[model samples]
Target chain A: MKNSPTKNQISSYIIQSQEEEIKRIALELHEGVGQTLYSLYSGLQFIEQTINSSNMKSYVNEMSQLLEKTIQEIRLLSVELHPPTLTTLGLVPAMKSYLRMFTSTYGILVDLDIEGQEPNLTETQKITLFRVCQEALGNVAKYADTHFIQLDFLFVDNNLTMTINDNGKGFTVENEMQRSSGLAAMKERMNLIGGQCLITSEIGKGTTIDVLLPL
Target chain B: MVMDNLYNQTYMKQACEQLQGTIECDFVGLAFQESKGPNIGWKYASGNSNDKYERITLRYGKGIAGRVLSTGRPMEIKYFPQNILGKALEYPIMLAEKLLYAYAVPILINGIPKGVLLVGFRSETSISDDEKKFVEKAAADIKKFLSLEKM
Candidate 1:
């Protein structure tokens, strides 16, 4: 008789499929729509230069500006969906770029500190770490209502520990865990990879999340 | 170029107020792509409970305003959070305003959709066809106002 998968196994399968779908959509947005918009922008610029009538030229200029905005929007969306750097440059660089964009978008200052060299990690490990940070940062942006954050990456011995701290209005961790799926997802992601995700927060104090993965 | 001189926040606020009153809705908002910025944001609102909408910036195809701008069509949600395609949180305006129903129409400029005019109700009430048409007409009027300033 064939054995049925356990609950944890089913959830892991779902998470993996979700990541794959996100990657596919990101690729379509970047390579398909992004390229098409770029060509349209170039085509409009060519027409703007070739057109003789001032009225027509101004109209083309407006169209070009709209297309430029659309292209930028698509680029940002695609990157946020699935950063290309995460696959090519590894975790540290990918997190750095994502934090930069996050700061620009939300006006939150992230003080990122690293200790020791980045340990070699499996592809799943790298993505899992990146996603945990992404989810934590997103929650901070949405609910923390703070301007400053601290991110620490410590690679010591055979373990990689990442700490995210926010100086914001915090909530009761237990209540939030029950109320928010984002928090649950972060914990589930860490558990799936044999890692630990610790979240501690008080009502008036700030929040801190520590993720530790054994290498 | 000409937009810099004619972009009036007061006019937008007043338009939003008038639309809110006309539709008998709890909230009315106008979201547009700033000429100098790549993102879309709610610039004007009427009957807003809080100013949180100002902090929300949406990329194209993300939220209601973004969806309308991209599709160049009107969108309606009579029962929000229920029977919706995406998460209720994705529609920040609705969530922030506690909106139960919403209708958004695109404001076109030079034959291209450039902005969104949204009317929302806090109560779960279905908008009549006449009300939808009124909102669309208001969007068209706003489009004309925007285009007229460019010339």
Candidate 2:
């Protein structure tokens, strides 16, 4: 007799499908709406130069400006939804690009320190790590009230470890773990990939998240 | 370009201070979309307890400033964290400034909303109609200044 899938397996499948859906939407937003808006902006510029009346030219200019803003917004949304670099250039580059955008958006600087050579990683492992980091950084931005963060990536023999530390107002780990679905999801994602996530915090000191994966 | 940005910053600071004085509010903040990017951030603030406002950046419809920019309208919250549509965390400005009441109006440039001017009160108080008008006037002045600077 065939065995039924476990709860963890079902949730893992759901998370995988969700990621695939997000990737598809991100691609559509980038290539479809984003490109169309760019062309619209160009067309407006062309019309602006040909128009003889100053009033008409000004109106065209404003339209172009609005279009430009929309294009930028769509571009950012697409990247935030699913960074193309993660698939193309691999984890480190993708993380760097994401950190840059995160700093620009939140004005919180993340100091990344890498140790040892990067080991070969499966696609699932790479994506899982990326998603976990993204979720962790988002929490830091929302609740940390911090201006600075430290992310350390360490690679040892057949093992990879990542540590994220924030020097901001912390909370009780037990209470927050129950209250935050994001934290739960992070742990679930790591567990699906045979990894462990540990979170520790103090009220006045800070919070630290450690993720360990064995290859 | 650098000089123009500096000029805008100085002007915005002065305008925020003027508005805070006239409106008798505890804080006044000006958030603007970057000229080269889509990020909207609080660039200037008056009566700010800390520099935390400068660290906040929102997308099109996330926070108070973002909502005002997207909707192109004025928004007023008399009792914050209560009767609000979403989570209190969504209003970063209110949380950062510890404000109980806030009024935000869009700064329209060429009929396009490109910025937000917000006034907040730490203590619970209803904003008078005259005070609302002052905020609107301040937003108009910022719109005018930005439009002229573009040329």
Candidate 3:
């Protein structure tokens, strides 16, 4: 099941469909509701100026604060659902931006490094790799009780690999692989891209997830 | 919007500090039910080793935290380490944190539980009744905090 073409094709089909759906929802949230909220915020700014009374202005200010949080939340949600940068800016930039956001939002520091030149991969492969990284980071946040996460994307010798490692309380990989859907999903995503995922962990040590794709 | 996040961070820091000091627990966390989803997960944690508390999206009534959310009352587990809490997956925070004794109370706003305040010990010990009361008191303070949000 690791490198089965049939599985890849099927997984690709299913993932493509899901991506389409998620893309649609993300666009709606970003372009549709996001624009509306942006406009609403503009209106509040107008109200803030027009309302001369200090108390009234204070009320407007609070409302504006709340709306701003909502807007940021929507934007974050949209990106999480479908990262526009992954499609437009390519993988390296996408991961950099994502890790920055992850650190800011979750207070988990991540160090990302890229080695060798970027390998040319299809849109499907790129998204698969990005998704795999996302899943790996998520697992680190959930199960790994560590302050630092490390990511490396290397392209060398006609092979592309991404390793996400964290210094957190690690679990037994075999036992967790069977029970954790997140770990399984990361593996499945790699398999769908005709790549292999290797997960290693030890109790009280840390966990490392590696994805290797043949270029 | 950034201000709201800052405020939350400050509040969480204060809450956790006070709660852990009073409850004598190694760690404390707060989780709110998502407005868009029927799930609750940790939003802030003090003395936290990781973000495991933030990663869970518990459905109401599904697990220990969920139970507290559903019942809108305080609950305490005297012993842990794979004890009953629905399933292993449902207790990710406990499994990851290796908490022994735990207590949680609902943060109610206008009589509806909107969030939960959890405090736990890393090593196992019999939880005293006074410790449970401390949790309840912390929960009440949190409830007041939520009420301020309504204002």
Error in Å for residue B67 of model 2? 2.9
After superposing candidate 3, which stretches have Cα over 4 Å from the reference?
A1-7, B1-18, B29-151
lDDT value for candidate 1?
Answer: 0.82
What DockQ, on C-alphas, does every prediction get? 0.16, 0.41, 0.11
TM-scores of chain A across the candidates, in order, are 0.93, 0.92, 0.90
Expressed as tens digits, the lDDT of each residue in A20-123 for candidate 1 is 89988988998899999999999999989999999899888877877887888777777778887778888899898888767645546799999988977887
Error of 3 at B108 (Å): 13
Model 2: chain B TM-score relative to the native chain B: 0.93
DockQ metric, candidate 2: 0.41
* Pairwise DockQ winner, candidates 1 and 2: 2
**Weakest ten-residue segment in model 3 chain A by summed lDDT:** A99-108
Candidate 3 A-chain TM? Answer: 0.90
Model 2: how far residue A67 lies from native, Å: 1.2
Candidate that would win on DockQ = 2
Which is the leading candidate under lDDT? 2
lDDT of 1 by residue, B1-151 (tens): 1234435666777889998888889999888876675567777789987666776666567557768887889998878778877655456677667788999999887777778899998899878999999999998888878777767
DockQ order of candidates, top first: 2, 1, 3
Clashing residue pairs found in predicted model 3: none
